[model samples]
Target chain A: MEYPSRLIENAVGEISKLPGIGKKTALRLVLHLLKEPEGTTAELTEALTELRTKIKYCKDCHNISDDEVCNICASHRRDRSIICVVEDTRDVLAIENTAQYTGLYHILGGVISPIEGIGPSELNIDQLLQRIENNKNEVKEVIFALSPTMEGDTTAFYLTKKLRQFGVKISTIARGIPIGGELEYTDEITLGRSILSRTAYQQD
Target chain B: MEYPSRLIENAVGEISKLPGIGKKTALRLVLHLLKEPEGTTAELTEALTELRTKIKYCKDCHNISDDEVCNICASHRRDRSIICVVEDTRDVLAIENTAQYTGLYHILGGVISPIEGIGPSELNIDQLLQRIENNKNEVKEVIFALSPTMEGDTTAFYLTKKLRQFGVKISTIARGIPIGGELEYTDEITLGRSILSRTAYQQD
Candidate 1:
């Protein structure tokens, strides 16, 4: 589509570069920004600039942070002996929201996907190994909380092989039907796995 | 959701302030930006800043433009005797893309909507009237190309009442079933309108 102004075209071009956002949505957003007060655009640009330029990652877990280490890594109440390995910061947030896991996190940044040209070396695998090696006695368990995709499985397999030599207990999060999911609608693989991994019923 | 960094939180907060964007989507965009090279984020912010700061409106039609007068208004090829009144720049672009209309445009910026607290005074209706008054002899027609909604009808009605003394012909774009629209799935109102405004059958 032809834009009336060069500035608008440029703004739309830049915004549409983002994932899931198309040229139409970008134009709508740019037009919305034009309609809002000048301060609104200023604040948005300032915030994005600060985020891109000054944002830091936790030295230990590779999760997003403002300081040398993330809060989860620094907290004394967290179980430092167990590290929950995940793909990215979003996964960390999702697991944290559950409030069931008190262990520190090890953000691998991404999984080992050959199709995407992301290998084990491209991720935080070395940092994770170093973390486990530095406190071998203190770190007892390493839980793989990555997705159920093939890439996640490959990464977990790779990490398991590395951790076996260190004599650390390695586990992966369970794969099964979601809590509220109906058995009939559940995928065959998930239903089959759920049945195979079934536990004894307990009275509440 | 808990954000690991203050900068991430701030960026998400600002981005979520935009229309249609939520906290989750904002975080996803922010995280994507973080993963990309810093230069990408810088370019996006720079473009938006320049757009918000340097954008101009057409002096004659109120459409977005790089200069005081829009290209449409300055074009000698356009029909000066006819003016197509529209809601905003998007409408102008849509009409232009059709390549059917050769007349210049006067962007109302918005329609008359009492529920949204938008009155005639809030739009560029006065400028449109002034344009017609200044070029009374040259201008022969004023076409209303607003959406087929209550606000649009109200705005058109108000303008028609104002322009009654000018002796200029007033018209509106046809409202009916769109081309390529299936009759079975078309809304009753639109189908009824199509039947009511049926034109003479002409062989191609």
Candidate 2:
């Protein structure tokens, strides 16, 4: 669309380059920023630029960090022996929010997607292996917390093969009917898995 | 959710302030930016900041502009006698995309929303009146191209009252069933209005 101002068009065009944002959405967002106090946009700009430029990846898990090692990896209270391997920092945050796990994370950065030219080598696979090798005795179980996609499965299989030699127990997060899900609405594959993976129920 | 880094957290917080973006979406967007080349984030930040800080409003129409007068208002070919009044620059772009209009435009900046405490004083109402008074002989018609909302109708009613003494022709865009709208699916009020405003069909 022909914009009245080139600055607005440029701003919208640049913002629309982000994932899930379209031209119209970009315009709306830009207009919102324009209407807001000057400090708001300036703060947003500074924070984003600082995030991209000065941000560092955790040495152990490859998650975002202000320093060389992330807080989770450095914390003595966290169970570093049990590393939860996942695709990215978002997964790390998701699992952290659950409050079910108190372990360190290994961000794979990406899945083993050949179509996207991303393989095991493209991610932090080598760093993960080195981390395991250096702390072999301390590291006990490694959970495959990646999404239940084909690529996630392939990556898990590859990691399982590599981790077995280290004598570490490897497990995957369960995928089945959710806690509040109805049986009639559950998908066939999930329902089948739920039945197959059923454990002896213990009365609490 | 707890972020691994303060920078990432700050960026996500700022981004989540935008319309339609939540914490999860903001984190996803922030991670995507982190994965991309540094130049991409830098450019987006620069463009948005520049747009917010340097962009000027057109003196004549009060629309976004890089100069004192916007392109449409300053252009020699555009019909100076006719002016299309809209709420903001987005409407200007929408009408321009139609490729039907050749007239100038007046941006009201906002509508009269009593609940939001916005009235005629909040918009560019006085500037529009002055423009009409200064160019009384040259300006012939003023088109009310505002959206069809309660606030839009209220603004139109107010403008009509103010413009009656100017002796200039004033009209609103047609309101009825849309061009390709299905009759069965059309709303009651729109359908009723379409039937009431139906013109005599003449064989071409």
TM-score of every prediction relative to native:
0.97, 0.96
Q: CA RMSD for every model?
A: 1.5, 1.7
Error of 1 at A165 (Å): 1.5
lDDT of 1 by residue, A1-204 (tens): 889999999999999999989998999999899989899999999999999999989999999999998898999999889999999999998998999999999999999999999998899999999999998899999999989999998999999888888898888899999999898999999999999998789989
- Mind giving the per-residue lDDT tens digits that candidate 2 earns over B29-55? 999998899999989999988998899
lDDT of 2 by residue, A79-157 (tens): 8789999998878888888999998899999999999999889988889899999998899999999988899999999
Tell me the TM-score that candidate 2 gets on chain A alone: 0.96
Query: Which CAPRI category fits model 1?
Result: high
Per-model DockQ against the true two-chain complex: 0.93, 0.88
Candidate 1 C-alpha lDDT tens digits along B85-143: 99988899899999999999999989999999999999999999999999999899999
Regions of model 1 farther than 4 Å from truth = A201-204, B202-204
Which runs in model 2 stand beyond 4 Å of their true positions?
Answer: A202-204, B200-204
Q: Deviation in angstroms for B76 in model 2?
A: 2.1
Determine the C-alpha RMSD for candidate 1 after optimal superposition of all C-alphas.
1.5
